[model samples]
Target: MGPELHYQMIISRTAELRTEAADHRRVRQVEAAKKERSEGGLRRSLFGKFSAA
Candidate 1:
């Protein structure tokens, strides 16, 4: 293969890998936010019940 073609292929592959990594990071951030919210709700509910006593 020509050097120019090889260089282009390398650049394209790098871009694809970067996009995939960003997507994975975004998904993890969303999941973490959901988990934090759920845990916070659970804590509030538990304390609310105890505080009533």
Candidate 2:
């Protein structure tokens, strides 16, 4: 292949990889937030029960 075509292909591949990485990172952040919220709710419920008693 020609140098110009190779360069274009490389640039396109790099952009695709960057987008994939960003999407993966966003998914991880969402999962972490959901886990934290659930844990926080559990803690509050446990405390509430003890405090009421």
Candidate 3:
């Protein structure tokens, strides 16, 4: 293959890799937020019951 074509291919591949990495990072952040929210809710519920009783 020619140098120009090879360069273009490399650039396209790099862009794809970067996009995949960003998507993975965003998904991880969402999962972490969900976990934190659930844990927080559990803590609040426990405390609320004890206080009410």
Candidate 4:
């Protein structure tokens, strides 16, 4: 019973760590996409102003 309980605890802890790492990766991907979009918008605005002038 003691060894079985310890094994279960290790499994659960490993699963939690996996989930946290996946979440961190997903967040970084989302932030990178957003930064790219904003930069693209800035470039378009600048080009539009030059064209208008």
lDDT (tens digit, per residue) of candidate 1 on 1-53: 99999999999999999999999999999999999999999999999999998
Each candidate: RMSD to true structure? 1.0, 1.0, 1.1, 2.1
Pick by TM-score: 1 or 3, better one: 1
lDDT of each: 1.00, 1.00, 1.00, 0.99
> What RMSD value applies to candidate 3?
1.1
TM-score of each prediction = 0.88, 0.88, 0.86, 0.71
lDDT of 2 by residue, 1-53 (tens): 99999999999999999999999999999999999999999999999999999
Sort order, TM-score high to low: 2, 1, 3, 4
| Candidate 2: 10-residue stretch with minimal lDDT | 32-41
**Model 4 local distance difference test score:** 0.99
Count of clashing pairs, candidate 2: 0
Candidate 4's displacement at residue 30, Å, is: 0.8
Candidate 3 residue-wise lDDT, 5-52, digit = tens? 999999999999999999999999999999999999999999999999
The lowest-lDDT stretch of 10 consecutive residues in candidate 1 is 44-53
lDDT of 3 at 13: 100
Best by TM-score: 2
Q: How close is candidate 4 to the true structure, as a TM-score?
A: 0.71
**Superior by TM-score: candidate 1 or candidate 2:** 2
